[model samples]
Target chain A: MSVSVAQTALLDKEPQFRHAIPTRDGRTARNRARYTFTVLAFLLPSAIPLLLFVLGPMVAAAWVSLHKWNLLAPMQWVGLGNYAKLLTDPITGDVFVHTIYYIAGYLPLVYFGGLALALALNTALKGRSILRGIYFLPVVTSWIVVALVWRWLLSPTSGIVNTVLAAVGIHGPGWWTDPHWAMPAIIVASSWKDLGFVMVILLAGLQAIPTELYDASKVDGAGWWRRLFSVTLPLLSPSTFFVIVISLINGFQVFDQVYAMTGGGPNGASEVVVQQIYDLTFRYGRAGEASALSWMLFAVVLAVTVIQVRGQRRWVTYG
Target chain B: MAEALLTARTPARRTVGRAPRSREAKLRLAGVIVLHLVIIVGAIAMFFPFLWTIITSITPGASLTTTPALIPKNPSLGAYQRLFVERPFGQVILNSFLLAVITTAVQLVTSSTAAYAFSRLPFRGQNVVFGVYLATMMIPLQVLIVPLFVELKAFGLLDTYLGALLPTFATAFGIFLLRQAINQVPRELDEAATIDGAGHFRIFTGIILPNIRPAIATLVVFAFMGSWNSFLWPLVVLRSPELQTLPIALAGLQGQYTSQWDVIMAGSVVSVLPMLALYVFAQKYVIQGVASSGIK
Candidate 1:
């Protein structure tokens, strides 16, 4: 009797289908077919493009990496020749080293700068919104514009930075013009542009932390420094981990700024992985080698991301 | 329990707050001032380059050999005029605007549909398909430029806007964001619509779209900004000067006008102003989106 009542209720609920309701197995089969068709229909617009452009090209990249073909020439089956060349090339090694150097400098500076901004602005202060806006302005600006502005600002002789430094009775380096200073200059510009993005993410994390925890810590006779170290940093570790991963990924792919500001100049001091790939493909016409180097970069980025994900277990804390 | 906890904590707080109220207020005021001062300095540091760019752009005859005055004695729009009249900048700006708009619109439609499918429609291999989309997000554009360029060439799309727009149409990030939003819309809404004999299209258009307005707005801003500020792909694909986008044009100007700081700065200002305007209007959406997703 209960089963009959439930059946009636279901029939009443789906009134439009009451008269046409088929056998259970037949209905289920028809519904499944309908669902499959609808899913395909909905997915078609994006799937076509993703498959044609993104997914297809990814496979093509791997296939191309194993062969040699310039734009106008016939293809040659290279079967790891490009990989052998890329692995042995001293310039490829230098490019990787430079990319690492950039990450080494950029990761710390951007992370700390962003952290400080996030911490400070997380407080209750008048016009903090405006301050956040100012800090984040560069993140929205195109890298090309930022790079050009920085190149002009660090113009060695007549730039404002050096002018201000000279006012304090200090000499300034040639910045982008100086080989030793080129990567540093790029790092500075990059960090300045990116710190705001980091701050926004970290600020969200900061706001997510429960105030009750702070209250409890205070009730336990903990000082501000102790609370910060034991409570704040530990609780903030997940956001910190995220920021580091993003910064590391971006730092490895540093291109537009390097391309515009220094052009990997001052005798190849700032030649990075992407810039090198671009040069090899477009400039030197070593299409196979360029494809191979890009794959190498892919490997490195993947390895780094995997390691971070695995390493987060030791450091990251969850509430 | 709350009263007990408050009272228990009051004694410790009172000891720490033993100083006179007025004195403590004064100290707090001092702290606020110091905080403001530090932030203002940092703000200035962040804003100075923009300020300097504007100053140089208006200062006629500004050069790299000598610094222009902080406050220009005679500000002029000569450099901006030169950008439009003497160069192909007018067309370039238009191209960037057009491409950004079309890209944003296409992405909104594609991402929303795909998001709906992933959220509501269960198919065989659904998880695997979704996983493929997520994994693709890890492979940066630099990794696929070579093959993409060749593929475009095969289709006779190189150096065209089609080539540039095709690769950016379906972004994994957009789909992820929209799917998250679609999931939050109560399933009952769709079920009710279904009971009312509403088809999937009608339900999607009437229920889901209306419910996820904020997510749509966020996607619009990101897609527009991503297309507008894109440099690398356009740089690789576009060869004709007439087809140049803003970043490529700006880079070209930088290389061509090695010492003409005024004109280069002018281009920089022009390129940045639209972004600044969009940012001001959409600051909340942009900030909230970034905070939530950590997307750059």
Candidate 2:
């Protein structure tokens, strides 16, 4: 009986083992096919819209940049003509300079102010959440709302800011209307709206820092300022880098607030690249010029992003 | 934990080293006080504008002389009434809501499916595809507006809701965020389900989706807010008044009623309410979304 049982077990095991290899291989091939299909199926939904709207438009914009075609007119081929015009155009140059000036004035306040807020809120103090919420309110609010409210607030005649300044024996400039103050006004409103975002990001970076580091620094006899400069800032570099890059990108694309508040007014003091693009395309009936300007803006943004990516290694430290 | 440690060490050090310890404690207390004071001032400055907006909106005949009041002397809902009666403001609100909701829903579907593929599925050139997706985030919508407009026109979708909605239907940021969320989910659960003969779809729907609810919630708030607040594209598309979203309609109102600050403020207040309510309710998810995603 034992010998018969052993013989049957051996007979069963031999055929089963021999059949298992090819079936396993077949299963793997089938699984691979299944995975490939699933991946494609999952990707197509996003890929279709993204390709149609984003990637395809990028190429199309490039094509449009090379040709002149108003909505009603026949297409005219103008290879590099628009690009040459963008370089020579005084408006484009002024817009580019203004964009830079705005960035220069805006980014520092956002970064430092944001870091200060984050540092304050990072403490285990009461009502920190409320403070955070207050700071963050403007971030969720629409840019148009912010612009409108600010426009009302900064009105030269009746606005609260000038009124308060008058009470304090200080004269406030005509913010949105004055060429000197228009960009500054936009910058102030933008800083206010964007402050919360930077603060929240920095707060997250701050919280991610382990308690052990602070304790260790304390034990090492580092004062608050020293500890902050050495440990906190170094560790928070990545978030700072992120904020700088994002702010620069958004700064380059400043449109909504400029549109709502100034309409690039006071002789185009606050005219940005996007506002210029809008005028060229719709108002002036120069789609080709607009497309070229758009490409230029894209190139500037891309260059800045690349520079930031490369420059981050100098300052950004990871633990 | 650090706070406790600092307090604990202070008490211990105080017993042995009284003079310096006391000075340090006093300094620390002063620092805390100063910190709180600065934060309070900043908070007030941050909140004062909104407060002013609210006061201005409610105050009847809110003009130059009666401006900057903390409390409205004679508050009225006349401007709000004027907003709806004078213009198709209610319809604009509906349009904004419909667009935001539809955009959010579609973005959820597209982003989640693509995120699942990027995070879980192994396929050829996955890295390259994902890199391309991420690259899209750097390309601002302003760059594509002209061509996108042309493309929509080509498809005869110009001045339509579909045109406004199509460009926003898929976002690289959403996909990146959701993919990061999915990556946090444990792979063992997926493996276990697969061992039970479950397919990728089942695992994605059952395990992955369930685990990433917070991320989804975060994305919802973001996408909703984005769509609700979107100005440029909606401004460019949707030429007709009937199809106009709230922001565009508000811009129109501003143009039409340039000096009617009361009505304009009222429009601003009304447009901000829904989003403010959303933020108040989903504050946690929104903050966490921004924090975890590490995007502004």
Identify the leading candidate in terms of DockQ. Answer: 2
- How big is the positional error of residue A139 in model 2, measured in Å on the Cα after superposition? 2.6
User: Cα lDDT for residue B80, model 2?
Assistant: 89
Q: Compared with the true structure, what per-residue lDDT tens digits does model 2 show for residues B79-184?
A: 8898998788889999999999999999999999999887777555876787667556654476577778878989999998998999899998688667655654
Assess the local accuracy of residue A115 in candidate 1 as a C-alpha lDDT between 0 and 100. Answer: 87
The DockQ of each candidate is: 0.31, 0.34
Give lDDT tens digits, candidate 1, residues A173-271: 999989999999999999999888777666656654545566666667766566667667766775687578657766777888898789998999999
Determine which window of 10 residues in candidate 2 chain A has minimal summed lDDT: A13-22
- Segments in model 1 whose C-alpha atoms lie over 4 Å from true places: A1-45, A122-124, A151-174, A177-180, A200-243, A309-319, B1-21, B86-91, B109-143, B153-160, B173-219, B235-244, B252-259, B285-296
Candidate 2, residue A187: lDDT: 89
Which digits, one per residue and each the tens of the lDDT, describe model 1 over residues B84-166? 99998889999999999999999999999999887777566876787667556655576588778878999999999999999
Give Cα distance to truth, residue B222, candidate 1, Å.
3.4
Clashes of each: 0, 0
User: How does residue A4 of candidate 1 score in lDDT?
Assistant: 37
